[model samples]
Target chain A: MSTTTATSGRARRPKKPITLVGVDVYVITEDGIPKFDEYGPFKIEFISNRGTKVWPGYVSPDLMLVNWYRCRFNATRPVTDKDVDAFVGELGKKHQWSAVQKLWNYGDEAGFSKAY
Target chain B: MAKHVITMLPGEGTGPEICEAVRAVIDHTGVDITWEYEDIGLDCLKEHGTLLPEKTIKSIAKNKIAIKGPTTTPIGTGHKSANVTLRKMFDLYANVRPAKLIPVLKRPWDKIDILSFRENTEDSYAAIEHMVSDEVAQCLKVITWPGSVRIAEFAFKWAKANGRKKIQCVHKANIMKMTDGLFLEAFREVAKKYPEMESGDIIVDNCSMQLVRNPGQFDCLVLPNLYGDILSDLCAGLVGGLGFAPGANIGDNCAIFEAVHGSAPKYAGMKKVNPSAVLLSGVMMLKWLGETKAAERIEKGVDKVLAEGKHLTYDAGGTASTDEYAQAIIRAMDTL
Candidate 1:
């Protein structure tokens, strides 16, 4: 087996950042409790700046959601601990008690704070 | 008549012999084609330090059409498949493979003419992977709406153009709801526009069983990358084997016609392997270039030779060598 590097053989161009306009969140609940798994509790549909729905624009329910939150709002400033707190606070208000509480518990259990 | 310039990658191993055979047969049909030869596969890797060189890509890009022989890809290790790389780089999303039975071959079933439209890019072929832990690894199965819609539209258009009545969308949406579900949704969305044509969906596993059980039941099939890759080869088995399968990777701007088989390295210099796959691929190339008369001549000649059950290579259960088989096709064409 010849160890050759399989390159695209085409010139590389920088990828333009996709501008997110809005998001549709479908929250799944079981027995009045938010069901969370690898796919996350909510299925997110991202609407691009061009009004086209971005396929595969969903995010996992990990610390990555924080990055998605920042991008969705177009926050150019650096992320702060206060920003993370406010994001979780907004989620609690929008999705109600059980889901946000479960997310926070999972965050703690997964050591998301330390990782961040 | 205007001469057509085509990129010809004879590839490696038995590629050269079969490609020369196709060239000779095409010449006998009286089509004026200037072959722009390029190198790929292991030999090119040694010289250019890449499986696909810049010159080969340039030639194909300039000509906008290419006919290639089988290129070798290492198993389980080494570089990525040059075939997959070419398809991706050119955005050749639709891989069209037809399985039409030659009456003389006389397999288990007769009247098997099925065309498979496979999504050539995306899905697990994206090659995105990561190791989360020492014990676990993950690979993402990527399926996008645009990718799905384009391939579905291509399949329907080709079917309609070819006078095919039914088109089936093969998928496993029942299992991977979101990923495969998106693919199925796109197929349905596209099918609605073609109300005059019949359209339906089938699960991948069930589709496989149905294909072998009754191949005549399927007219055409459209599928995503992985499923298409698997099922297209299965369809090839229905008519004969890969030696009889001719494939095309088509996109909006460009198209590539190729043999859907591997370079038989063990029989590289023997000149005993069959050249039917590459020769049929040449027939496809002629049709793509609007040289219908030449295409028909080659097709008729091949059919005549096969029907005679003489002058066939070892794979076809005959004693003739590769050059002898090719010469027989040329002689048959002269009669036509």
Candidate 2:
């Protein structure tokens, strides 16, 4: 038997950390009424801001409880409750009160300060 | 010839029996292989308190090649899948499973040869799941640019090398605009590099229907983790079942060959399960090691045995035990 040490020929790529910047939340509705279903009602996009470049993050329907609209965004920087308050403030500007109520009800029911 | 050292993970249940049979048949091929035995799965969990031991990982890392039998993973509860863990730990990003018509065990499609390249790491297989509340839960599906690009590059290279004429990117991009869309985009970008190859994209649901309707239309398929996991099994069904399917998890540094089927704990020592899956996997390992002549000899040996219809195990519609079937293949190899 002959002996020869084996080595990997493939080159390794440098690992870079992807930073999560913001999140886009869209309440799916039919005829301006919020549609409660497993596939939708709330569609979320976790936007990533890698270095100075911004790219579209992964999108998924929040298929949790039909009543509760809660989603988590993993970010390189800490996401404070103040950040969520600002996000909710933006939601109030664009969406109807009834649609926005679906989000706020979570905080009301769970006795939390903000909708996350 | 330089003797190759390989990490041998004889998994669990019928894993040991099938691994033994494959080892015997591979030895018959006359390739110089020194197997470094390692423990994995439930038995290892009992002894080492983990399904995968550090020593086992070190062995595969050192050898850069491994052949494993089917390992049992606890369902719903207990530790995560040992197979998934190994793939993630080793960064075995590309999972290649080839389903071809074994002429002897004749099926509907005479020319069913579909090679599937699955993105092994990331996607939902990342297991990044959380319970938002008592009644609510979510599992994040991650798709990174680097992850997608590497897998696409790997698939295209593999297709070009293997003389595959066409390659299809299977995804649910229509519904998943960003995640699967990025996966499709990466595949298209990679396809541009290989101008000689024909490339196309299909929605995963449509691809599944097309596969069952007429499998011959597809040559090579590349998909993200979840879809690839599901569709590879479907491709296996085209020629035969999981019993005849062989899989290989390949990374830049290392590769692990295994049977796509699960370890049947119920049939552990019965010696009744078929050994073709693991045997064919061994053939793949031989080919990866550049032992082409030995690989072909083993393939021909297996084909000869199956064609004779005498020593097939229970899964293949015969009454022969696992050892009997393995012996038949070894006996057939002598003539070659």
Candidate 3:
């Protein structure tokens, strides 16, 4: 490897930026509205989806961590079809399913916030 | 080179149409075929308390090759699925589908071609379901080393044998680590043996996106049973739809070929709906039978008839009925 010339300019080596290490999901359920309480307070962990990794499930709910599916970030609330419809509709409108998948579905988006 | 038997189960929700469709296509060939039919219906729930009869499973065990139509898997616990029963009973490890551009139909895609070797026997389809509570339900997804190894091996061998260039192990390794993780681990282990072929891992969801985006880039994809079911259908959509998809369930000792389609109950007794999937499935059966010449003739006839698109079915944007399309295939065969 060739070293950068100190007189000309210092080469900026590529470095992975630090990111939010943990997140969780919780939803406030309004009275009289029943949610699809199928799976509750699901913990999402991130992992690389491009390369080879051991898998018993077929998709990544998270794409941030490595070698673990038990994520500290959790989404604990009853999800409604309206929410699903609105999310999908918004994704379609913006052509942003891929982006949305990163944040919520695959857990790759670095910018996840708690939803009420 | 040898005679084979194909047992057909056009189970509940779809009746006789698929059976007739398959029979019409194979009639074009000279190969010797023996078949059996099961007197099954939704009544199986009342009589046997099951959708799959013990006799049908025994028949599959004895002959090893059976073509079937879609069956009803009630979302409830009343009767288990016949498809799942057959998958478990035979340990039919690989579900294979071939989607090819027919050079006739105008679709959302062009020059599209895909082949899939899907795991047939295990996963959530294991029928290991239980009622958790009044508010929730659970289906246990079981993935074992042998299950993963068998399917992955099938993918590689199929890719190499079929002149395919790559194998993708589709998985969701993020959420359920141990279960999905085992599948990925087995793929990595098995991938070492087939360095001559390319291997890639696509997360199941992305596999969905990329497939719809650029289906032409894929060849010989391997997925577990359930995921394969969904992906193969998606690929079918890229080329045509389920009506053009042909499939086979193969074990070490036995095999069966059939149309990879659903029961269009609305078209029942109408002598309609495309028989192309089952007809091509018959062609695949011919290939498996070593009747490559007969298979070629059937496929060529299908190409010729479908290329015209005039005698096509409603799905193909034509008015031709099932019998009409079958006759078209037959007429194409006679000319061939």
Candidate 4:
């Protein structure tokens, strides 16, 4: 018993940290405009439809509420995927997401967040 | 030749009484076993001031096998359970409880036989609970990959050795994706190695329903600790109750056989409580020791006595005392 020490036989490596640049989600609505109700107060700059900016007030009575909206949210600091997931998940509790696109910054500084 | 040395913990309450009856039946089988008694549980608490004495643990460690009577864990006393302590000390990870139908007792169905493989030593049974707030308390449910794999391997090896045709991996993988998912995943990996045996899985809730509705369909069931604790008792109800249930805790180095039923302190010294459970546990001990002939003899004797319906304890609906019921088993052993 004295000879045995409390340690693992194998050498273990620590986990690497994750860097999250921003989070993007496509939220759908039932009866209202996506920008007014779904994308609550974040630095969401440009709303797009197949690569076209249909933002600021895209709500029109003639346009049917097909209920699909995609907005990109920028984080103040680099965050992990877990951080982005928590943000998106809390939003999901009230609003439904037809689809979610997470935009990551792998340190290339390609400026995908600045493209819009 | 020297007899096979086996450790015995007489336990508390009816544990000692029923154990004496079981010892008598084992004696009649004519197999030589030198009993090494150890004071544990309540008896040890009285003398040594601890529920599980160090000597008791050392004895079982040295002997490698033991048949124990049911020990009482005084509730709300803040002391850790002697059973849990012993299991953790030895890393006794696999808890095996067999629920076999007895012809004497009436049931919803007949010929129902099930051997449950419970992953001991983990799950909420680890007892890592904390007060989240004044109104709320929470317990951590822990699951590990190696714990799952070893129990799965143990279950499959038991199935292969015992000639069982199918094994059911019971879990709630849909809800507890991480914990039960790992459990089911390990079971699937181990099942692939046994080509001859049929392997499948069922969710815990649906598995409980299937057990009561159609218990005979299940051959061997493997599950995590919590679900196993619940479902094993449910299976026991299918074929009478705990009196007919026998349990075994299997580890790499040591194994302990025990009656899954409680030690009825109220019925202590009355000689009225049924001894079949512990006696059957002794049958399990004999088999574990490789005394297959003696094991079979005692099993048959128990069956014959129960089938005759002449000498059963009050729980089984007869007028016989605990010792008398044991004597009836012994009397029938002559034919075996």
Candidate 5:
């Protein structure tokens, strides 16, 4: 499909209410903690809670942000594919974390190595 | 009729007929024209040594406004770029181009109306332009806090004044920080003021892809210098062509609106040229003059003439020559 059709498709999809409590999502071992926080090279900031809520229209409400860091983070290298997989894996294996009513896990933006 | 001097730097390879068209405006308006005319030819490369002369620079600085037909920037040439020099010297921070669906001309998308307020100075357009090395020549991308804040502030103000609904700050800060990052940060700060308008920050790459795909979703795009230049041209294409796209170079004390397209040398001297870009730029100039009523009349005339969809040059999908199109617009003005 055209990029328009795809982006419009993405824009219109209904999103479930989800929040990334920065505390849990950034646990050191599950996903590498962002340590080089020397305010980064510049003040790249997350201005709003813009992406945490996914709008996955007719399909199931996507709890996971399609672009994982869409939850908001600031850095130089950009949030990578490996980062997404780690977040999904960490949430999937623990205390029914991935299936929380307020949030659910879609495929990690990184890749499709099945968690089941 | 308030008289204002608009300097035209046709330089070399400028066609004869285009000169007459510009002269016609001066004669018709009966305005004193301060012709900042100079033969900034190849010799200019050897002497005071620039494609754009210090004389033209002083004229723009003194008048605070000017217009031009076209200027050729020879690629890989030793001479510095005239346009880049003026844009930087005057600190003309914001390059504002309005892309409206002209009354006729049958556009592909109705929902597309975008005003691009591109950062004019820094970024790759800084003309810090040099060959970094034999294998890897480079242009620096320097995005600053003040640069970003100024452009973002202008975009929001522009949106507020024009009744636009949304604003999008396009950048590639995801990878290139320090420069693009500063712009993004300023957007965050300034955006807080205009809560009325919905806002989103898009990666410059995604914005480029989407603009061609769905020009509809966008309204106002504020970006760094290079992205603005590229995107504004794309917007010009959507409405009709660069011929219909009017642009304004604005700073704190001054504003210069002009024909955004280049001076097409091959088509020079042949009255078969399109003056839509220059005339539309004139309309913008009037608006800048605070003569909104005259600007409205000019715009309405332009709309009616084009809506009739006849008397258009090659670009506007009609057989009419340049003068014929201008005549139609003048007629539209009289009827109004």
Candidate 6:
């Protein structure tokens, strides 16, 4: 009868290390691709146009605008939110990107091998 | 002994031309002011890698008082505004702009005299913007309780000191609940202590309408960063254009007085611009320095020149060169 206990009261578990981050930035362009550049330490895995991956990779050209771009970067080491924020902050200034979002890669690896 | 060691920046383009006008008035004051000139804006940027050099910061820190010309801020996205940089550097949290009819300038509202206090440091002026997605970009509007309280306190204290009867807080709290809410909340708290002055809050849009409809009803107004930025300019238009508006960026340590107008690069050497804004700013600087006599003297001289209506810039509806208008003010001081 007491076997089923409430899990809602349990403390939140710690988040896994950030292995990857997806930053969404707004720059005004119709093509939606940032000029490819070495990000230093972190490698730019791919860039996406709207929702479709467009760089280091390709999606249908019909679905891309040059102004908005989502750049995904791969980090060898697990990154903290602070690290991601600071990294994005620097990148934002350099490229004058209007927005940035950090996406984490954890749990299991999926797409890279299949895409490669 | 010199009353104050003030830093004077001639700035870029027409800046130098108008600054000379202020210099003439300063000389007539007989305040024995020691002037330390500094280079800033486009000229300094070209010579140095940065728009705001370390030397300029150090000079303001040392002098604690500066009177400057309008530096050119590039339109669109280029170098960040030097004025914004200086404001952040010194933590100049209060931007005070007083707009009043000068009798010389022909305007609809002759009785419009509004003293506006704008919170300078926080809100969108922080410039912390980032793109959340390529399609969605966001600039963070930070409104802290301390920032709000300090600005409100400054407004109330200023109102009490200046004998201003009513103080109005301008905000868009209904739309921006949290940020603008914090601002209005703090303003109300600060307004409580100043029982002598009547205080109220007006939604920014309505305040704009009221300003245009009946500007005489407003005695003093306090606003958050972006609203203040737009409203101050609108208030400036009530009396005259930016050419007639003088601004003071003040903090605990330093105060910078300057014309709120832009540097008209096309008319750099033409000397056909109004120097009233910069000269009035000098009057403000003198007032801040406790050299009230000198301040009043300069203001009266300016009043005389404006009343004479003979030697004025084309912008002010006359045909006097920049130097000629300044000479007129100085000559008026001689009579004072």
> Top model by TM-score, which number?
6
Tens digit of lDDT per residue, candidate 6, span A52-84? 345663222222133555566666465566666
Between candidates 1 and 3, the one scoring higher on DockQ is: 1
lDDT of each: 0.74, 0.76, 0.65, 0.78, 0.62, 0.78
Residue B58 in model 2: shift from native, Å? 1.1
lDDT for model 2 comes to 0.76
TM per model?
A: 0.75, 0.76, 0.70, 0.74, 0.68, 0.77
lDDT of 4 by residue, B188-244 (tens): 999989989999999999999989889989999999999999999998889899988
Clashing pairs in 4: A20-A79
Looking at model 1, residue B323 earns an lDDT score of: 93
Q: What are the per-residue Cα lDDT tens digits for candidate 1 across A3-115? A: 75667465554433322222222233223223222222233322111111122332111100100111112223344435545654555554433222111111112200100
Worst 10 residues of 1 chain B by lDDT: B128-137
Q: Taking the tens digit of each residue's C-alpha lDDT, what string does model 3 give over B164-194?
A: 8888889888877898889989998999999
- Tens digits of per-residue lDDT for model 5, B1-336: 236665655544432345455445333333344555543434355676666666766676667777655566767534455665556555677899988887577867767789999988667663322222222334445566767888899899989998999999898888987788888889989999999999989998899889889998899999888889998998899888887887888877666666677667777667787777767776777677665676677678778877787777887778887777777766777787
What does DockQ give for each predicted structure?
A: 0.03, 0.02, 0.01, 0.01, 0.01, 0.03
- The sequence of per-residue lDDT tens digits that candidate 2 reaches over residues A1-116 is 96665645554444333222333333332232232222112234221111100113211111011211223232234454456556566555544333221111132232111111
Model 6 stretches with alpha carbons more than 4 Å out: A1-116
Tell me the spans in candidate 3 whose CA falls farther than 4 Å from its real position. Answer: A1-116, B12-14, B41-50
Give candidate 3's TM-score: 0.70
How would you encode candidate 1's per-residue C-alpha lDDT over B1-336 as one tens digit per residue?
349988999999999998998899998887888889999999899999999888888898888899999998888547778898778667778999999987877688867999999998777775543332222345557677888898899999999999999999999999999999999999999999999899999999999999999998899999999999999999998888999899999877788899989999999999998888888888888998899999999899999998898998887889898999999999998898
Q: Candidate 1 docking: what grade? A: incorrect
Worst window of 10 by summed lDDT in candidate 4 chain B: B128-137
Shares of reference contacts reproduced by the candidates, in order, are 0.00, 0.00, 0.00, 0.00, 0.00, 0.00
Give the runs in model 4 whose Cα sits over 4 Å from its true position: A1-116
